[model samples]
Target: ASFRGVLTNGGRGGGGGGGALLRRSSSIRELPRRFSRQLSRRRSSLAESLPDTPAGWAASTAVLSSFALGYELRLQRSLTAPPLVFSQSNPRNDALRETLSRRRPGGRKGILTRDIKPSLWVGTRGTLSSAAAYALPHFGRKRRGECELNARLNFREVMTMGRDGASVGIDWEVPPEKYDSSLCRRKTSEERQSEILEGPIRKPVVLILHGINNDASFGYVRSLMRACTDRGWIAAGYNFRGCGGVPLTTPRGYTGSYTGDIRDAVQQICDRTASPSVPVFLVGNSLGANLITKYLGEEGYSGTLPPNVAGGVSLGNPLHIHSGNMSFPWAQVLGLGVRKSLFLTRDKWSQMTCRNFRAAFLKALLVCQTIGSVDDTLAPYLIRNDPVYPFAVTVGYPDAGEQYWDDASSYKYVQHVSVPLLKVTAQDDFLVYGSSLRKMSHCLECPNVTVVKTRCGGHLGWQESPPEEQREGEGRGFGTSSWADAAAADFIEAIIESRRKSDKEEEAIKKAREEEVEAEVAAARRRRKEEEREGGGRGDDDDDDDAGNAHMERRSTSEREGYIAARVAAAAAARREADEIRSRL
Candidate 1:
């Protein structure tokens, strides 16, 4: 599915420093740097040429749509914007369009990323924000908002540094168009019996998720997917509703809701696929990781296991639920999905939901503009669509009095978990502060949870590239290590081993109980026989000399037999365990 366009000479694609030169040249060439300075000073309004309304915006989109489209990209009008004299030629306009495009259908933005940030106090037992009186909930703020890492052609993925180990991958998924409940129900029923999912994916699946305003095909995801698939891991991506034309029945667009959809999708994979012993690993970036962390934590020991859901790998799982809501301050940096969960959510609103709900969805879609106040920033969300949950208590069901927050928040369930989780984060990630990422390590007392934070990788952007590439350009400088593959493979392997150990332990316990019961039964039989021999012991006075001697001997023999039985059972148990462990190793 690689596009065949001959790329112009650049350093980005490994033309050495050529890409950097080309980028600089392109920027300079694009509208002249002189114009950049002067143009801002002499601003022009869209109204100068056309009215800022829906019709005008539609006309503008019509013009832009005429241009060629990438395999994963298409031009369209912004639902929140009205018809206006918009042009792709506008620098800021292009950036906005690109952001929207990332959130589009069939490709781009991740649907399962986390949203909403709340901070609970560390030791005193209240939310940190409430104690700090942090109005905006921005704790770990950085300088850079976005990071771009040039992927190595051979690996075809992004690499980022982590705390204990380096992990890497490209994560991508296209949103599906049209999600009719009837269709999902039919599919769900079909899934029950068993159905083969037809697709180009033939390798073992390694699911990947992207972040806010970015689809599965975003740079990091694309690189990781290509990398994993090439290395024999089947790769797949998913999109939120609305963005991929899945169409949300609810008026609200996609927000980072920790639904069990990913778990369902994994189950679907197990039910539908036939790759025996193939490990299905989950990976998420940015907010996607946030959602994943919450999902995994909520899964605890009680979450349903997808047959092949061996393990999970998360990059920058911003566990600071309450604090991650703030856009990174600037330079600071940091760090699955399921299907039954998918039907409950979406990417864009259909303008049919209740006003409050509409505002929530819209807030998710629109990035904050500080030039505009928080009230103004939230205005689009408050008025555009709805969004929510309760504080202190477990999150209730959506559309109900209580949201499922209490049940879904990662912090709430980290201690009750049974699976292995690996997290990679950038130290400078503005979205997820390194301190917070580091603190997660403390919360997860179990050895199963591993949190790795690097000096960089900021906010799932993992901007740091390789040393050579880091020397190339501004955005290219941040060197990111490939932590996804190692973390993923390691986690899955650990799960396989853990499961085997559990099985062995259970078997040993069963054998020991069986031996205990048998020994007890045999002793009872001997005692009964002796009682009959002593005339059912009806004449107790008959237990004189000879009878007392016989009974004492029987008691001694019974103790010895019981000891032997217990020893044999224990020995058998130990042997079985040794065999199991040896085989796994």
Candidate 2:
């Protein structure tokens, strides 16, 4: 019988007897058909409402799955407890209200502001389940599926020679069409040549560094590049040696602690832009973050930091590599799909092999179940055997203790970083332990470093909100904007703004000092002129006195001569004897 008929009979008089009759008429087989039809109609309506695209379908599936999970969890919770009674004055409700009302402490001053809260979808709950629900769908296959929806990006490959004489590939993303037409594009080869001869345009640049075995072409990295371009920044990504799908010129590959490639890359970028005055920022994900932080600390400590690098933003960077390696097994178990995706870079592994290297390569492929195992197995052959390994050892991991974790850790160098550093990580990041991250709390003592720890962005995944919850200005690009991307962009902008304000203040002070110095010089000139004039008048008076004295001396001399002649005549006889006696005396 139809549900309508059963409900109609159940509502009739005779109470229990009417309900029993209604139940007896309602057959399970009939119910299934009726429900199937109803579900089919609803599905058809949903299909029509959704966009006819893969992203839309994936999004719809994710939304439905999330709702279903939430419903199931709620059902389970309800089954284990008494039925909830809705009330205005429930103490539990009041406590929940209070908890929701309390605001989290925002980012401090400088590069980050705590005021920039995560979207409601992200910040609403801090549970691992909620985090997985949001992260898995958006960051999972959905991101890869939606790659075509992203804004058009122009990429040019530039070959930079690494410190070890290896040719490194840097996929430099040209500015978006809007900025390219206005600020970046050159009209002719002659113009480009002239600009190179003179200097490239002075535009703010953002350098994007991808995760281990990943290149600039990855969807997440592209999203970050898009974010930078959207803000009118010249963004580029440095593909570590063989990771760019290009064969390396040398036998060596990039390592976590080796910063030589990064230094060379930064120099090339600065030189290409011809704008050392323009601010440059580093944005790194996961292993990339480790490398960047290590570089920053080491260079900062050695006082070899490039003058153009203004600040850095690290997302899902495992500071403690040893701990990160230890968690790899767990991450593999929890995110097997993500782990499997890591092996897609067979090109990199293929480049690391030789006649003797095949054994190690096969070993890494077969025995390495986690990223850490791969690192351990491959490092001895691919990295340590390189000719530059000795030099790297001298500069990077000099001690036995440091080499235990492949010297990939960044904790020792954290304190030495002087520039503004924004380190963002999700609480439920499977690869990085909370304890390991907690050890980095000492970095907070350094005023330039800001750590934004969210409850949920998994690993390098900062997924966007579902369609219904998404708000305007909350996200940008192919799908919902990632909170990490937003935070990094905001921090970079803040650093740039701070630098601008600082530059303006310095200019103002310099101008004021110059004006003051000029005023002093002018006053000194005026005083010198007045003194010269007064000295001239005094000289004139002295000349007049000298003339008068000369005239008096002449008159006195004439009178003395006359008196002497008369006296000499009278005393001539007596003077003769006196003169002789005086002469003898």
User: lDDT of all the models against the reference?
Assistant: 0.42, 0.59
Candidate 2 C-alpha lDDT tens digits along 451-485: 66655556665554423333233343334456566
lDDT of 1 by residue, 99-132 (tens): 3233323332311121111111111112221122
Per-candidate TM-score against the hidden true structure: 0.42, 0.61
- After superposition, candidate 2 runs with Cα above 4 Å error: 1-153, 176-199, 323-325, 328-359, 382-406, 466-479, 537-585
Model 1 residue runs over 4 Å out of place are 1-203, 244-249, 275-278, 323-350, 353-408, 441-443, 461-585
> Residue 391 error for model 2, in Å?
7.4
